[model samples]
Target: GTRGPLAGIRNLGATCYINSLVQSLFMTPEFRAHILQWRFEPQQRHAMNLAYQLQMLFKRMAHPSRGFVDAKAFVDSFGMGTAAYRQQHDVQELNRQLLDVVQTFIDKAGTEQVLKRLYEGQFYDYKRCKRCGSVTATPSPYQDLSVAIQEISNLPQALKAFTTPDEIDGVSCDTCNDKTTVEKGLTYRTFPQVLTIQLRRIDYNRTTFERERVRQDVHLPLDVDVSELIEKSVVGSPNASDDQDENRFELQTVIAHSGTAYFGHYYAFTRVKRVERDAAVEAKRLEEGEDATEATVGGEWIKFNDERVTVATPEEVEEYIDPASWKRRHVVHATKKKAAEKTKRDAEKKKEADNNDSNNVNDGGDAPKDATEPVTDVATTTTEGAANATPSGNAGMGTPVATDEAFAFGADLFDNTGAGGGGDSDAVAEKSVSGSSYYAIYRRVDLPLPSATIDTASLDVPEYVLEATKTEDDELSRDAAELASLRSVVSVGLVYRGKKHWVSCKPETTLHELTSTARQVFGIEDTLHLRLRAFSATMSVLGATYPADFTMADTGATPGSSFTLLGVEATTDAAIAKDVWPTQSITEWDRLMPIRVYQPEKETFAYLRDLV
Candidate 1:
């Protein structure tokens, strides 16, 4: 049976299952490794404590649902339940034990030695600051080196058999040592350290493997012509070998140690060049005024050029190429071609016109009678009358004929509408017979006149007129007045989603009631959500310190009211009391007083504020 408060809860079966799950979740290899790396470290202790607290809080709040409860019950009823719990408990205990062991190993190994081995045999080319004139210790002691090597090698096996390879690189100097100082006079020394190991296979590079395979399969024939082979290689011929005569390889390795610790072990291989002189020449040129230039030989170096090499002046170079002169010559040649084409076209047009004139002269000479026909007096009078008329045959000669009206009538006539065929015959006849009419004869003839029909339906009004009418009937106008009144009552602006919200309420209204009214009137259902979030924030703050009273009110003049924000004050008090005292004090009145006070205050403020 469990001891203390959990004594009666013992043998409940559910408790054991919960404990096992918690242990399994928290005592995994990854979690252990993380704890080992950071826990107890002065810099990381606060963060670790926060994480642990949050985890415990989350677990306490989580209520196992129906499925999880059912599963737990079934498992607990089985005979294997006890064995599983034992296994998880044993693992948890073992992990805790290993943590102490790891710490001991780290203490014995020494951090300085471990850091040095991490960069062993690597080309670090350490340089000392000229001002400080500090040089790193050469060849750290053998005892420290062996301890570091032993610790690192044993770590892989010690970490609960988690086989995933990991590499970490760390650098620490005198400055870092000063920064990582511990309590007391002892200082935490720092040195550069790096560790490299594969963690997990997240993805694979198939393309890289295929390319490597292709590269290995390539071969070249020894008997082939040298120049032909070169050309074939440059042009990417299928028969050309990728592993040609020029190929070479380079490899590098390094081992290092620090005070009682292994720093690192590293190895690498890369392609090397056979023509050492070529590299020398490039290096020399780089040092001199000459820019590094590629050899004329066709290969990777074909496109390379020496940008630093000075040659001819800009003017001299331009003279040599003569691009401007060439452009001018090209323009002159194009202009001459265009001129020739234009002259040919003009000559063709003139010839065609001369031929047409000669044909007209011959035809007229052959038919002299047709050309000499005279006009009769009636025809002359008719022509003169038509010219003087309004063209609509209307005798009302005062009626004006606008150009647009005349054109429209012409268009209608072409479209076969009779409106343009002739003006009103009766009116024209009446004007023609009138003895005093100056345009009597002209009125008798057909003419065009403006159409009298008006299209009143086609007129359009501007959009601003409709908008203005809508503005006159808007509900927002009333809401704005109410908001103004609410603002006068509240001192602080009401906020929703980080923006100030205008309200309409009387002064002395509580924030809680105002929020409720705002929700109903403004359809702001999210007000409750906001309150809950604020309550959470208040609780968090109260977890550290308890305040005297918690009241919420809209500072806006509209619908002014105060609502005693409930639960927050009590919740805050509870959290602070719990954290500070290690246990809660029991008093029925103590628990209920805060709630009772808050509820009445909320109701009173809400009621009085709404009256406004």
Candidate 2:
């Protein structure tokens, strides 16, 4: 939805499923960059020419040209259905085919190819026999890992579930040379530069004999450790100076499927990494002699729904994955408080005025009009026909009533319309309501705002010393705000899951307050775990915690600078700061093994997530 030329893809029927797959791959910056450089050096790059077609199609997709790129050739190569029929295709099926194309393309281009550098990974296969207890090991190459979802709620749990060993009976073992009980295990031998974890949401139902889809919400973390899944052990230091043995992965693009197996829609939410750029240029404005504003750019997450693209917040992206999280938090509005106060004050003032007027007499029925009164109390009617007609009830409603201030105040409140309406008339006969003197009475009726009291009970302060502690805390909060206002302000954006979002904040705000504010903004109560990532003009900082002691102004972030607010699990009951459970090194796996994905040559997801 931002300022960009958007491109649309023609539905072409059930092709929407595959369209989601294509869009997901196209948005991966490294992969797109590799495809853009396709020279087709090898003519038979992947025998079916799948890679060449993909490069051409993706290039067109990235182009700013208006019309939909012809994806017919690319879709046809998959052999899902008749070209003319245009039947629906499964996303995972198309996903595997696309990987095969890339893998073969890399093979044809040899070891030095772009696809090979990005997609190739080594995996180890281990099988152990119960008879002799000898384990056999083998290695194989992979473009991606298809991990079963297993109905787990999070990525770490799903990967853990996937790595569980399978038991097989009556299997011939090389060591035993006879049929025996054996266990088969698959673990990561190496990690690809662009590691893709396919959530196997589709599974077979034994009773129904049909492919069933899983709709349960599954959570993914911003940081995940797959080192436990590695078959080999770290040859060097586990926590090396470079920290590669950690083998952590950051979420990049998510291809979310929203429908059942028979019918569904596909869209993607992608993380746009930061790059060094000037705000003046990105904003398309640069005043002469204006100081240049530099920034760590691309801290935004955008959603691609077919051709329609829009910016999304971290909360929105989370809600997209899990529908239950979509409920928004109720807001505490300051205006509503003011309105409530005004209402109460007016009601009290009205009661007081009513009591003051109750003791006066109404001339025992009808009285002669006073001469000095510029406004009339009743219709002339020859002075009410000299009271010849019947005298109406003095206290009756809808009668022309006069306030004591007809002459004392002004004529504006008299409702001096051509028709002799009273001062309380709905219509203003002479002066408009704005110019009327009624506001004078309104000012008199308004009472002062009452002093606010600190809720000691909520603070759990004992009644004996409640007054003493409440006074101290309240004074500190007020004085802190005033002092913080003296410093310059820093604007921050919340970065969570796979997205970065903008949030407004005052200058001199500290991280502890920031966390509380974010909780309110996102409608979270109780425990909220948030970490701030600050970006400077040239680079971004990592691991900034929000403590009450430090203010954002202390971090040296620019006014228009971007920050990433990463959401973490809120822990209770003995939470360790680092090297804790789940994230603790290599213990969760059934079998201990070395981390295999550490390589300085290829950049991993961990490096990208922390990219300055």
Candidate 3:
């Protein structure tokens, strides 16, 4: 095959559904090599081994003419035969079966446990007695996790709900020897090189006796921190420091379903990156460098949509999981807006051109020969419109459209400055990096230094600025005041659906009050519970949890320091975020929201169909 990256595979009937997944695995260089190199000694009659078949299938897909072939033998190997093969099969089911065959057949690290080493994470299952305070910890390993997407959630929220402690209904403590209440929770102990999570999208409605699909969006952050969920983490306590490794994961890929559950198609977006040693340092350089000495080179993002492969530009990647961004209505709205703007521009240009012609005729043979004179278009433009309007003179002079400012994503979505710096910013330009020799030891805290504060309000204007920028400075000052208010109050930073938001409140504020503010922000219908999340190593913060009565002061975090607020459902254990036991419900709330749980192994999407 010609090198660089392999071409998209052609579909072979319904077999192409699995081909989408196969293509996803093909892109993963490490896993691809691991599977390809694994030897399966047993030969099953005239048919090829599953590994060999997958190897051959990928090999064929790599070619141009023979892009893909029907996997008649591969499907037959499942043993369900034509009956199951002819009918539609769940993608999750196929994924589980495929992985099971490989994992079971290929025991490369017989004693070491190859599959677990690569995909599994061990958890300490804790059961604590209420009477004696005695705790029992059981080490259980889980290869994959299926997170229930309660309301609208992101990756971290789903994970927190999964790893958060659950209540053991009825269990007797061994030490106490009494059938009293016991609190159960899962503490993350060990993780893998590659972590795979399935967002449970299929929900069964008992009333209708039908499976419903949840199309709510979940945003994936650039970095995912699983440290606070780990049992050894001290973030929820008073002594949680900033030194612990959070086991942060940089999101490399996202496989998304774009349509309804029954008729939906699957596509994937992938960013080429690896977890760097230092997150802070890595955050500084989000793009690859040109230096050959660089250990890793990346930054390109590609969209794999079945046989249609294309570059997913930066803006497309930024709104990867935004539900609104993907809707056809959004596209229509943008199209109409552009059409209106063009219509207006065309009318104005016609008027301007007519005026220019009239002026030439009025002063016949007296007009200047130089065509570089200021045009009537600029003279007629409003202050606000002039700031955004393209220089009509450039078009008149026959300048190329490639260098046009009208095409940038302050208006032109494609005008991307790499993750590191800006296209026109002085800081990104050629400059020396030197700290002042005038370092000061302040006895007391001081205001922010001018050099340290970013002048984000400045526009690179060429003397012909619309306004004096005094209004912008005033706006920045107002924003600074607002930020100060956010810090001084309860100063809670709510992390939900993979986004962080800060809001101001009081220490005496009730859980309902905090959640009420959060609900308004997220526009969610479910009752939200505010739990104390670990202080991010990236930010100094407070720890706050529940008794439903405990105040923010109960966590012992200082005022004015930001607190981490994690949004959870009131139906789930409200105190799970703080690793505490929740009080019992008076009535059966399970009927309120009937949860259908299904798990078939790691890398498999959990569907209610698998259960029923």
Off by over 4 Å in 1: 1-320, 364-612
Candidate order, TM-score descending: 3, 2, 1
Worst 10 residues of 1 by lDDT: 436-445
Q: What is the per-residue lDDT of model 2 for residues 37-114, given as tens digits with 9 covering 90 to 100? A: 545544454425776667656645543433345577676666554642366665666667776676676445445566
lDDT of 1 by residue, 106-154 (tens): 4245343332232221111232222333333222211111101112222
Q: After superposition, which runs of candidate 2 have C-alpha atoms over 4 Å from their true positions? A: 1-6, 40-49, 65-70, 76-85, 102-111, 129-133, 168-181, 233-246, 274-299, 320-612
For TM-score, candidate 2 versus 3, the one ahead is 3
The alpha-carbon deviation from the true structure for residue 601 of candidate 2, after best TM-score superposition, in angstroms, is: 72
Stretches > 4 Å off in candidate 3: 1-4, 40-48, 62-72, 83-86, 108-112, 168-170, 233-246, 273-298, 315-319, 322-612
**C-alpha lDDT of candidate 2 relative to the true structure:** 0.50
Candidate 3: C-alpha RMSD to true structure equals 37.0
> For each candidate, what TM-score against the reference?
0.12, 0.45, 0.47
lDDT of all predictions: 0.27, 0.50, 0.50
